[model samples]
Target: MTVPPEPEDRGTLTISPSVVRKIAQHAADRVDGTTRAERRIAGLGLGTHGASAKVGGEGNDVDPVLDVALHYPAPVRRIVGDLRARVTEEVERITSYQVRDISVTVSALLPDIAPRVR
Candidate 1:
């Protein structure tokens, strides 16, 4: 956990990578064209459901790499741009850390199922 120093010197705060990951996941979920999926390995019995975030850099400077799933029929550029901005804003606001960069990877594209018409 690392906290940025403020002029007021209110006190020291600590933020963990897990907290960043959760923030990113929530941000991704808020995006209309994106969906978080579960990553699983049957043989290894390992899995993670929802968006994953990798935090890099030291102290106040933080870089987040997000892996998320997109729904079909979405505009890749637009969705990615929104996702990056939203995630950065949310993480920075919550942790009070400077978000240097955000990398978004589309892990999968979910198919859009239409309702059947008789």
Candidate 2:
């Protein structure tokens, strides 16, 4: 979904933000260390069909900015970093678009804390 450099006269058609989200989600999921932990669908307006657009010409470059919540068991920093790299690579490879940025938000940490019994 790479957008080609076009003339000013030709209006640049952009893909929907939701579409970007879906693609990001898919790409992230494909990575070994990442998963679709949670999606803040509220007010995001990510519809069921995803996003699509028609540029004036071929090679519509994909401009994506993803806000992802990645979950890790432990060693949060290392895991997160590896997950980020994998996700970025997958997205770029699969979509063939220049990813503006992939923001990894640490939503929760999965640690087996000892249960408290009174």
* Predicted structure with the largest lDDT when compared to the true one: 1
Residue 9 Cα positional deviation in candidate 1, in Å, after optimal superposition: 5.1
Error of 2 at 95 (Å): 2.1
lDDT of 2 by residue, 9-67 (tens): 57865555455556566655554444343324766744332112111212444444434
Against the true structure, what is each candidate's TM-score? 0.76, 0.46
lDDT of each: 0.81, 0.50
- Writing each residue's lDDT as its tens digit, candidate 1 over 5-98 gives 7767877677887788788878877988986565667656455466677888788888889888888878988999999889889988988889
RMSD of each: 6.4, 10.5
Error (Å) of candidate 2 at residue 72 is 5.9
The 10 consecutive residues of candidate 1 with the worst lDDT sum are: 42-51
Clashing pairs in 1: none
RMSD in angstroms between candidate 1 and the native structure over all alpha carbons: 6.4
